[model samples]
Target chain A: MTDDSIGAFRDELIDSGLVIDAGVEGLYGRTLAYEEIVSGIIALTTRTGAGDGAMAVHFPPLIPRWLLERTDYLKSFPDLTGSVHTFGGDDKRHARLLALVDGGHDWVEVLEPAEVVLRPAACHPVYPLCTGGPLPTQGRRFEVQGWCFRHEPSADPARMLCFRMHEFVYVGDPDGAGAHSELWLKRGAEMFESMGLDVDVVVANDPFFGRAGKFLAANQLDDALKLEFVSPVSSTETRTAIGSVNRHQDHFGLTFGIESADGEVAHSACFAVGVDRTALALLKRHGLDPGRWPAEVRARLWP
Target chain B: MEEEIRQILEEHGRLPVPMADLDNNADLYEAGMTSHASVNVMLALEDGFDFEFPESMLRKSTFESVSAIEAALTSLVGTPVE
Candidate 1:
């Protein structure tokens, strides 16, 4: 059985007659998936700094180890961090690794795809920086659009291993925490609704405790993972979680000892908009017919 | 204390454990307890008690088991465990 989402996007790509990766195999699909996802991320990031004076920052796709360590990333998500490693030996070892890359798969596992592990979630990169900087007396907030990686071996294209994460952060605000989350939630709804996806708000939980996540999953529930916007795709409740209004609830703030004007520690929240799947959901929602949908929306995205 | 921890585990989908016999030096990591689950437990603890779990107390040994969590909660609440 195929998910209606991947099926819908696949069909639309076929109908559009765009080049789908001709020789691709398995669930990753063809060219259209890549084009649609990359293009979708491009379109979303281009819309920021619109009237809110939002400054954008794009960090390295592979975050440094020290940075993740400071935020106790391993403690919270050891299961997710990808560690960068290599053969620890003399220059001969280094040469062997290089030979593999140049010789096209030779020299054994010498270059052992060591990692400065690919970032699992995008927000961890931002937290330590916020801690190091001079934050707002009230709180400093910024939005970043990042490409994140996960070890999801699931074949679902929607659950692709490499996906784009669009997350906005409201940091440093101690007393104004609730106000920030509320504002982001309102902004997120307008964006998803405008994209023409039938959106539904849900309270979700993080995928940390595999079994403990049952409450969120039993009825399609997630833990304190307060999810507000899910758009209908195949039928109804099976809609994708295109966007999440996350209240990191000062988890980051508390981790870093981020403080308000008086120097009292503050908490912060994040609103993550999963840009890639959201675009897929939008395409599914609008029938992937460019002509049938409003040209202005398309023009804004394409333009 | 063991019963309280069991209730949290049962209600929260966390792994149940026998923490009464578990001492401070006991190896919690080898006992099926994980730091990832500890965060969930922390969140559950917050919701269960309507109080905040300070990040200051999030050290490795803090969430060793049911007894440890109860001790932390007891300290935060300024009272002995029932």
Candidate 2:
């Protein structure tokens, strides 16, 4: 999309009271009306038999650095990771920090690293919790909702640095994991199509880091392990990945020592829906006014 | 050309098997070549062969095997080959 269109869309969102201008690129506050639509969309999409027996888990936005280290997140996304830092200054240092802030001289240098880093994805925390044992005979499923942070800052609202993801994760044997992801791929497509959005399910991969990451992305796509449900959010020509169904074959299982009931390293998969991006997609497609949306679309989201 | 491709594979493909042992049409991924490694190979190929891969040729199929890579290069360079 052109910069002009993106700027216009941002203006429309702010003018319509759907998005509050936080003055920072890639960061915006959601108004109550926008939040009501987001909550309604989440409720509608998550109303499913897929998560029937899934265990619900809630995670804080910040995860332990040790846990993140175990997941190879630091290795793959060193550039995008955010660590929590706090001021650990004595009186003298505190006085210096105050002076720096007062003079607007970038006082952030005084803050020391906390033990936790902002969580980058919704599924990483689930892997550690399910460690130390084999899953049940039928496998295990979990439903998680949490804020995720990335260092990416862009003018596009859909590419927010901080956003909430509602994810459903499954751990089991390879076959079960594959089946679960495939099912979600289909369900995710149907869910968005029913919502009146033209969605494309495409083979995709992560933005792995540096020179080696290029091959990683290609291999992931070659393996057909990652599928994205993309829709036109910011621009019609450029689609955004609003949801993704990923099949991680024994990667997490081996790292966390999780096993399947059959005595092999378990395979894992997760389907995550970007809640805010979906809301933004709705606004982009159906216009800023919800009243002008298709009758069925309005009913499904607002009713 | 084959030797050049093999050299690129050896340097950047990170294949678990030796370059000589890999079949011309064998799936590179099956031999433990990762996506990250494939990207390195792609860049190496572009540099060694003096050709740029278009967006259409950037998918997994383009780097699936030695034969596939050879084909992509031949197509990009627009030359006949075995």
Candidate 3:
């Protein structure tokens, strides 16, 4: 989409009460209707054939620093990671902080890094929780949801800095993990398409850091490790990847000491849906009035 | 031709090792060229050679090595490597 269209779309979202401007770029508060639509869609999507006995876990927005370190998130996306920090200051330091703020200077210097960092993704915590043991012969599946934070602030309403993701993670042998990812790639497409959205399932890669990361991206694409379900949320020409199915072949399992029944490092995969993005895509595609959407679509999400 | 490409790699490739030390056929990405840096190299090549890389030529293999880059440039200019 053109820059003008993207800007207009952002304005439309605010004007229509779909999103309440958080006064910060890439941060938004949803309206009650918006939240209902997103939550409803998430519930409906996750319920499809979801009776696989997956463990449901809800995580806080912050993850421990040591756990994040083990995931190599900082190595790949140091620019996007957000760490928690707080003021651990004496009364004298507090006076200085107040003086700085009163003088219109930066006062946040008093804040020190805390034990936790804002969770970058929903699946990072799942790996650590499942570590130190071999998996069952059928493998383990987990359903997790959380608010994830990244530093990529943008005017595009689809790319929020803090958003929710509903993910299903599988840990097991290579074949199971790979097949799980592949299955979800198809299932995710069907889910969106059924919602009357034009969906494209494509091979994709992560935004790895630096020059060495180019090879990593190429290797990722060359191996088809990531599949994204994209739809035209902001622009018709450039579809946004609203969700992804990723197969991390033995990467997480080895790092966290998770193993399969064969005593070998397990493979892992996750299917995550960008709840906010999908909701925005619905609004963009079907117009601001959800009541006027296709009966089937409304029934699917709101039913 | 190799020297010219090496100049660009050294200036813009952002490899860990010096461009001079890299083998002509060694993969630049393996030597530390990232996707972000490769875009810089691509732009530099375009400016130096006065040609645009076609979309079809924008694959990983096209910039895998110094030789591959030289080959892509050769094809773009429709002439033998200098």
Which numbered prediction scores highest in TM-score against the true structure?
Answer: 2
Full-model lDDT, candidate 3: 0.84
Q: How close is candidate 3 to the true structure, as a TM-score?
A: 0.79
Q: How are the candidates ranked when ordered by DockQ, highest leading?
A: 2, 3, 1
Segments in model 2 whose C-alpha atoms lie over 4 Å from true places: A49-51, B1-82
What CAPRI grade goes to candidate 3? incorrect
Candidate 2 vs. true structure, TM-score: 0.80
Interface RMSD of 1: 11.9
Model 1: CA > 4 A from native: A1-49, A72-79, A87-109, A112-115, A209-225, A233-237, A289-292, A299-303, B1-82
Clashing pairs in 2: A215-B35, A215-B36, A215-B39, A216-B35, A216-B36
> What are the TM-scores, per candidate, against the unseen true structure?
0.65, 0.80, 0.79
Off by over 4 Å in 3: B1-82
lDDT of each: 0.60, 0.83, 0.84
Angstrom error of the Cα, residue A100, model 1: value is 9.7
Better of 1 and 3 by TM-score: 3
Q: What does candidate 3's lDDT look like per residue over A6-25, in tens digits?
A: 88999999999888999899
Better model by lDDT: candidate 1 vs candidate 3: 3
Q: Docking category for candidate 1?
A: incorrect
True contacts kept of each: 0.00, 0.45, 0.05
